[model samples]
Target: MSRNLRTALIFGGFISLIGAAFYPIYFRPLTRLEEYKKEQAINRAGIVQEDVQPPGLKVWSDPFGRK
Candidate 1:
């Protein structure tokens, strides 16, 4: 391929990689803020006991001491 075409392809590929990396870490979380908030609230409240427990564990508390 021509040098200009190859350079364009490389630039496009770099942009695509950056976009893919940002989508999950930044854009997707922004779009799903409400869902993430609700999920976090449930976990904080220990609504699903099994999720907070492992074998032989009877109670769970926030290690950070946050209410």
Candidate 2:
């Protein structure tokens, strides 16, 4: 490829990297705990329900399933 084409490709790639990184660093809700919670709640309404343990699942504390 030509020098100008290579330079353009590198510049465009750099710009793309910067743009991709900006959203998570500056515009994403991951900057704070409250923001993350609010963002998660906005899209996932019923995913954070209560956790219940069944009677048969009581043996989950053991990794090897020993009695």
Scored by TM-score, the top model is: 1
Give model 2 RMSD, 1 decimal: 9.7
Residue lDDT tens for model 2, 1-67? 9999999999999999999999886666544657676665686665523354455554324222355
lDDT (CA) per prediction: 0.77, 0.66
RMSD of candidates 1 onward, in order: 5.9, 9.7
Of candidate 1, the 10-residue stretch with the lowest lDDT total is: 57-66
Per-residue CA lDDT of model 1 for 9-44, tens digit only, reads 999999999999999877875788777667667767
Off by over 4 Å in 1: 42-67
**Candidate 1 to truth, TM:** 0.57
